[model samples]
Target: MKKPDLISELNTAINQNIIIEKNIKEIIDMSFKIFKKLFDEFGLELEKLCDFKYSSYYSKHKNIDLDLAIVKYFPKKDVKYKEFLEKILDTLKNLPYGYKIRKEQNDGYIAISQETSSKIINYRFIFLVRKKTKTGYCDYYNRNGIWQEDYALELTKSFSLANKISNGTLYKVKSLLNYVLKDQFKYNYGCDAILITWFYEFFSRSLNKYLDNKYNKKEKELDFVNFTKIKNLKKWFKYNIDINNLYYFIFTKIGETNTYYYPELSFEPLELFEGITRYSVNTNTFFKLPLSYFSHIKVFDLRNYQDVRLIQEMGGEEYGYSKKAWSKARDEDKRYFVSPFIISGPFNYAMFKKWYVLTSNSLFKTLPVEIKKDLNSLRQRESMEFLNMTGHNWISSYYAKLKYLQPYFDKKYPLIKERDLKVLIRMITTMVDKTKQSDWLLENDN
Candidate 1:
């Protein structure tokens, strides 16, 4: 039997403004229906355990392909929540239709995808628990915000402990502390320290009052320049910082399950550091540290003489920090640590709209020559035909074509409005229809 023409079907779907198998509302409703059924099957009260929030799509267009629905489940003491969740996941996984379950720890979501011919719909759920404390109920979900002060104090205490462990070597302790906290506090790694500091400063200045002035002062004075000289920073960080004490503190306080890596020290290198020093925890054996153990430290920039010296001492010359190397590592880190596994349907549609704009602009000779050339290369008919012929789904086929064109579109027209793209698509579609008619007339007359 001959296969259905996927491109023709896709084009027809686009022309009718029906690119997705189901719209956002329908998809979300379907998800809830399925969840309700699952809950009923397990003799569970869905409403009692679960709450949901619908996040707006990226595009404001009514027919936007993607929507996000966050489902939060609060565990009760009487309920076997973990087993129930596992059962749900197992049922979903064993379904005949295509379903992907991704548990992302960082984002705190269990994303389940239901894929159709045209799109992959996502339902993201977060399981939250509240513990009874002396003051009140502590919501574990928002602990990062509530517990920032506690974390800062803990970190400060850890630093002091490290100083004592290093035989009162304050400089070494300060250098290593800076190295660990720099990524969390100053750098952009979505850590809690920056947020806590920002909130304190912003509110203090806005209200014309200092809230926790001591913390503000301490954070301000904790700059890298104040702790150690640029040259000696590397020496102290490498040789003098008590690795044993560092490991113990991190393992006990952060690395263990309870603290959730303590948002402040939650960078990937810390995970690597923990793994490297895992055996040393609660053991008398001293394992010789491998040179490669510090390899993940390259993600940090060579800040001053200290950073440069540290990198050099770690054989930076041999493992050159070229742009390509840095980019590769950064990309890997994003994939492993940052980027969400779930694809945003609305974002994908937005990308398609951008491509349409670029194509229309190129055809009408409005785009730059370089962009036109790139666009033409990406839209080569033979390549697209080949991809469609290979049984690739519409999402895969669209992205395969887009993989090359997207960079150019992003670089050139980063802020192309949705309304403008829609207008252009309509105009381009009308123009193409006229062009086809004219060609048909000419061919008939000939």
Candidate 2:
């Protein structure tokens, strides 16, 4: 796993890429030169240790060609890793737009800003680099390419620079040797090893498959960027990778499902980023908040609010009254017969604009006095029925604060018993003062 040994393994892989007439020593010398030129241009620096594997290297599958890719796992606290990656990207001008360097944090795998479009083109970047054994091959491959079957590796190991330069796992002994040489050489050597592994496992498969199918095969060539293909690839990855799999244990401390309030159906705010991020790759904003907040309660509680039950609730209307006639108040006795619900029309743009104004104002003003008093005194608020008559309406807080006197009116006077408006107002002030005094006494208890 030292830089020289890694240079040796890469030399073996590069020999397969193009026709090389030079001897092995000369081939390695030029290979490093070619790599350094490409490496410096790309701004990639390898970690002190990493892992690499080659697929189809010894197989008779000529059509398989080279499947190669590199996965660079940065430390959770290493903020400088990001800037280093950006520098490499600046140097490597020829890397296709689809060429992405993803930063997989605890929250989720975020592709570096420049690499959004690169995902579809470079399918291997999203996957984990598992040590490929004979049986493990299927776990690494999906519709797009090989993905890491296990996310647990992040928790169990610390990857060193020497692990990166070798075609297999690295140990302490070889890593120390690499460190003694130009320590930067260890980083560069590891970079080459990852590049070789990536080319042999992931990249070669994609490039070779496309070439063979595009020019030689009789089958319909797939546009790799096709929505249907992309969707299928995404679905395939989701089905195979268990959500419990952890990537970077420190930064990605939580899985998306564990942190998710509802994991069965993904309604997370980041999903909105997926929807718009596809079309407008430059977008940093997500659309999840509006959709979650505005989601209809009926749709959310589908079983309880079925159409059959709704129809039963609404059937009290007399056959004599047209639906339109029910729109206006008729006899005061008819109030019990009328359905209070109103359905807004599709494309009700004007209504939406008006509702936005009303709803925005309501949130601040609509706290009920009892609820406010409870919150102020006890640091907890009272719950309402959530039947948004008062709940959804703006300025209802002011009305709720008015405090109903219907019970007092019924008790105080039997006939012509409208409560004096002035008396009700005075009661509210008196009650507020009394509640404040009560709250202070309660607070003193603890």
Candidate 3:
């Protein structure tokens, strides 16, 4: 698994058209031409108001379908930046390609779309403002003549809870507090602050009750506790918990599950307050869009593709939800977790085999034998769990049934092979590793 050998194999795979590398390159070339034309027309006008640059060059290299650019504008003494934004939107609308634009109040981006060869491609140009306190910048919202960043930062500094509290339990506490305090605060003092205050009180009372139940016969000296009575609680909370980690969890969860597609625009509306934030694990930064800006943009249905439609006929949609099914689930419950399946199981298995070949050349070689054994054990356990959940025995009977079903299976139960299960585990674990090291917002002027 030398680097050179891996590169050669990858090149061979591309030459054979084993993946969608050719299609990706064609789209990237098309997107670049559109981006360059826009920059040529209004780059100078944009520069006069703020720092403007392209932000999705790295994304083009990945197997995604969208492109993005960003403009960072600092609030000036008396200049009207909103007017400039409107001018940009007007220019986009006037393009010969018939680009459609979508804008939102207090939002950080303008979404644009165009159709080419019967397929729609989406582009986003995010607007960012410089932060007042530091050299860094973030998306801000205007509230009562004041600009405020994400409330997560403020809430992180206000809560004092035991380090032993699990993240799952803390999330439930936050949800409960938010619901109870919504009517009382109503954005006057910020919902997060109100939630944190009451959450601290609730946690203290719960802990006291648990302690009393455990030591019913024993006489123990205890002092009455409250959030206000605790000295240096904010400092303790800051020292104990990493805010970045908490924000990362919240951001990733929202980006994955909390989205709705606008029927008119054919894309999801971007809003920072509505949990549309993207967190880059590598840089520890949060932005207003997902790593793949067009991931949730559904201009065409998955069934429209011939290959995907055939797979869906074979119970692809039943094995896991499609993008449309996922959106429908969100409509039913915004908090529902839906994992979308667009590619077929066999195709995924092939890709996973290729990925395992590439990584085994380097990463697997570096791990200790014991760790490798543990990973194999984990792969086995997960495979069994998946089989049990999917109700697939993966034996002779399963294969016989699959043959009888032909290209279509009963929608009630989907099935897969037992041997492909290991590859699936490898694929998921590798993706998680890559996400942790992803530079989703890499800027490239060239």
**What are the lDDT figures for the candidates, one per model?**
0.30, 0.26, 0.32
The TM-score, computed over Cα atoms with residue i paired to residue i, of candidate 2 is 0.16
**What lDDT score goes with residue 446 in model 1?**
10
Off by over 4 Å in 1: 1-26, 29-82, 86-111, 122-126, 139-204, 208-446
Summarize candidate 3's per-residue lDDT along 1-446 as a digit string, tens digits.
Answer: 43232222322322232123456547646655665576567642121110001111112122222324333345554324576567567666645556666774344446566555545555545333344543234434333234444322122222223212322233332332222222121111122222232233233333333334443224332232332233433333334433323322332223232222211111122221122122222221111121111111011123235534433443222122244544543354322222222211111111122223343244335545654465447454433333222211111222222122111112222332222323433342244336421122223311
Report the lDDT of model 3 for residue 250: 33
Model 2, 63-136: lDDT tens digits are: 11111222333323422434543544454454445334544332122232221211121111222223444422
Candidate 3 residues lying further than 4 Å off, grouped into runs, are: 1-18, 21-24, 39-67, 73-81, 105-108, 131-446
Candidate achieving higher lDDT, 2 or 3? 3
**How many backbone clashes are present in model 2?**
29
Highest TM-score: give the candidate number: 3
Indicate the worst ten consecutive residues by lDDT in candidate 1. 336-345
Q: What TM-score does model 3 achieve against the real structure? A: 0.28
Which is the leading candidate under lDDT?
A: 3
